[model samples]
Target: MSSKQPDTGRLTEPCEGYLVTPPLLEAASFADRLDHALTVLPVAAVRLRLAETSPETMKRTILDIREIMDRHDAALMLDGFPELVRQTGCDGAHVEAEDVAAARKILGDDFQLGAACGFSRDLAMLAGEKGADYVAFGPFGAEPETEGLALLTWWREMMELPVVAAYSPASEMADLPLPEMLHTLAATADFLALGVTQDGHSFDALWQTPEKFLPLFAETAKD
Candidate 1:
C-alpha cells in the first residue's frame, strides 16, 4: 500500500430512503401505498419485485407504479429484471452482483443500475467495477442482524461508490421507537433499502416501507 492515504469518497447525500415493493404485485393497492409513501418519505427510488404474479398483472402493476413514481420523481427500479426494464417503463434495474455486467449491457449507459452485494465485499467491488451505478450492501431479506453495519462503515470510508445500508428489523437496539441501528446508518450510506419490518416499525404492512425510518429523511433533505 502507498504511504499516502488514497483519496476515496463516500455518498455525499444524507442517506435517502429506498423502497422495495412487497412480493405481491397488485396494481391499484400498491399504487396507493407508493403514492402515500412518496408524499411522506424521502424516497430516492423504488425497487419493483415480483415473487408470484401473472404476466398481465405484472404489466399493469408496472404501469400503475410508474405513474406514481414519475409524479414523485423517484426512480422506479425493477429488481432482478433487467430484461423488462424498458419494456415495462422502469427507470432502472437492481440485480445481483454477478449480473452487473450483463445488466449494464442490457440497460446501457443512460439508465440507473444497482447491484445487491449482500454481505460480500468482493462482490461489491466486482459490481462497481462492472458498471453498476450503485452497489447495495446488507443482509438483503435476512432477519434482523448487526453484521451488515460494519460492512457499511467500511465501504463508506474506503470507497467512492454510492452505498446503500439495507434495512433490518429493530430487535437489535433497545428502547427506541425506530431501529436505532437504522439511524446509525444514515451517517454513512447513500440510500436505505427497506427490509423485513418489525412490529411498531412498519410503514404500511402491505408495502413494508418502515414508518419509523422516515424520521431521518423527514428531518433532512436529499438532492
Candidate 2:
C-alpha cells in the first residue's frame, strides 16, 4: 500500500456523518421527513437507495429529494445510477467497485463518484486511481471485523481520498440506540453509511437531539 497521504489531508473530526436512505421509501412523504431530519442534523451527504422503480418514477423521486438536499447543502448521491445523475441533477453516483471507472467517465471530473469497495484495499486503491471521489469500506455492522478496522486505520493514515465506513447493523441489535451505534462506528471511519433501518426507527427518532451525538463530531483534531 502507498503510504503517501493525498494533498487533501484529513478532516478535523474523527468522522463526518452521512445518511443512507431506506431501501424503500415513498419519495413525496420521505422528502418531507428527510428535509426535517436534515434541518437538525449536520450530515455531509445522503445516498438515495430507492427500490427498483420505473425510470420516470425514479427521476421524480430523485428530483424531489434533490430539492431538499440542495436546500441543506448536503450532497444527494444516486445509489447505483450514474446515468441518471446529470439528468436528475444529483451531486453524483455510487457505483459498484468494477463500475468505478465507467461511473467516473460518465460523471466526468466534476461530479462526486464513489466506489463500493467492500473490504478490499486493492479494490479501494484501484477505484481511487480510476478517479473515484471516495471509496466505501465494507458492511462493518455492529460486530466490526478487526481486519476491517485495521484497513480503515491504514487508509486514513496513508490516503487522502475520503472513505465512507459502511455498516449494516445486525438485525438482533435493532433496538440499540442510534447514538451508541454511531459512536461505535466513529472509532473506525470518517463517514458512516447506514442503510439498514433498525426496527423502523426513523433517522429523526434515532437522532432526536443534537446534544446526543454532536459532541462526537467536536473532539480535538486527530494526529
Candidate 3:
C-alpha cells in the first residue's frame, strides 16, 4: 500500500456521513426519516437501495428524497440503478464493483459512479480502475472495529479516490456502536454509509441520542 497522502491544497473538509435508505420504502415516511437524519450528521450523500420495485416507484422515492438531499446539498445516489440515475436526475449510482465499467459507459462521464466492494481490495481496485468515483467497504459482522477499521486505514493509505465505511441494515450491534466506528475511521473514510434507521429507533439515536457525541460531530461539521 502507498503511504503518500492525498492532495488537499485548500481548507480540507472533514469526513462526511452518507445514509443508505431501507431496501423497502414508503417514499413520504422514509423521506421524513431521512430528513431527520440529515439534521443530525454532516451528510454528504444519500443512497436509495431498493429490493425489487417498478421504475415508477423508484422514481417517486428519488423524488421524495430529492428535496431533502437538495436542502442538505448532499448528492443523491441509486443502488444498482444506473439507468435511472439520469432518468431521475440523481447525482450518482452505486453498483457492484464488477459492473463499474459497464455502468460508467451507460451513465457517461458526468455522473458519479461508486463501487460496492464489500471488503475486497481487489474488487475495489478493479472498480477504481474502471472509473468508479468512490468505493465502499463493508457491512461488517462481529469484530468490525478491529477488522473493518484496519481495512479502512489500509485503504486510505492505498487509494486516492474517496472511501465509504459501510454498515449493514442491522448495524447497531451491542458491541459495535456507530460512534466508535465513526470516530475510529474519521481520518480514513470520506463517508460513513449505513441504513437510515435500525430496528424501531431512528438514526439519530445511533449518533445523536448521546448528547456528548454531538460536540464531536458538530466540530467535524464546522470543518
Candidate 4:
C-alpha cells in the first residue's frame, strides 16, 4: 500500500448499514428483484417508496414481496403518503420535515421513522431528537440541482445521528464505482439510499441488485 492513508474522511467503521430502494414496477418484476436481492446480499433492510407507483398496485406489491422473501428485513417508506402507509401496515414510514410530528404520533415509537432533510444539518439533528430512526440527505451525485458534497460533509461533522444519503445512478459525473461510493459514504453518511433512476424518473426503472452493493462491502473490509 502507498504510505498515504486512504481518505477515510474521519469515518471509522466496517461499513454496514441499511440499503433502501423502490420497487415501482409490475408486481411480477418487483417480486423477482426482491427474491434476487434476498439471495445475494446481507440486505440490512428493504424499503418501498409508496408514492412512486399507483398506491393500490404498490400495496399489493409490498405485501407480495414480504410474503415471498422471508430472509430480508422489510420496511416501507411513505413519501408524502401517510394514509397509504398506514393502510399498507408497513413496519414504518418516511416523512418530510413538515410531517415528522404527525408521522411519529401515528406510527408510534416502536415503528421506524425516517425523515428527509434536504441539506439542513439543523433539520437532521431535529429529526434525531424528535425520535426519528434515521435521517436522509442527498441523492448524492453530480447534479448541481441536488445538495453538493460540502453540505453532506457539514452534516456529518456536526451530527451524531445516523445519516442517509441518496445515491443517484443517473448523474453523468458520478463515475466512482460502488466501492468508492461506499468509502465516501462511510466518511460522510451512515446509510445510503441508492436511487436507481433510469429515465430521469424516480422508481420508474429496474431495481439494481445486491451485486451493486458488493464493491462497497469489499472496500470497507479492507485494511
Off by over 4 Å in 4: 1-10, 23-26, 51-56, 74-80, 84-87, 143-147, 171-182, 198-209, 219-223
Q: Per-residue alpha-carbon lDDT of model 1 for 61-177, expressed as tens digits?
A: 788778787788688888877877878878889999999999999989877899989899999999999998788887433334456777777887777777877765544333346
Would you list the clashing residue pairs of candidate 4? none
User: What TM-score, over all chains together, does every model reach?
Assistant: 0.81, 0.82, 0.80, 0.72
Better of 2 and 4 by TM-score: 2
Local error of candidate 1 at residue 185 (angstroms)? 1.5
Task: Summarize candidate 2's per-residue lDDT along 128-191 as a digit string, tens digits.
Answer: 9998888998777666478888888788767888788876655534343554545666765677
lDDT of 2: 0.71
Give the top-scoring candidate (TM-score).
2
Ranking by lDDT: 2, 1, 3, 4
Which regions in candidate 2 have their CA more than 4 angstroms from the true location? 1-12, 172-181, 195-215, 218-223
lDDT of 2 at 72: 82
What TM-score would candidate 4 get against the native? 0.72
Select the stronger candidate by lDDT from 1 and 3: 1
Find the 10 residues in a row with the least total lDDT in model 3.
1-10
Residue 73's lDDT in candidate 4: 46
**What's the CA error at residue 3 for candidate 2, in Å?**
21
Q: For model 3, which pairs clash?
A: none
What does candidate 2 score in Cα RMSD to the true structure?
Answer: 4.8
Identify the runs in model 1 with alpha carbons over 4 angstroms from their true place: 1-13, 140-147, 170-176, 195-211, 218-223
Error of 3 at 136 (Å): 0.7
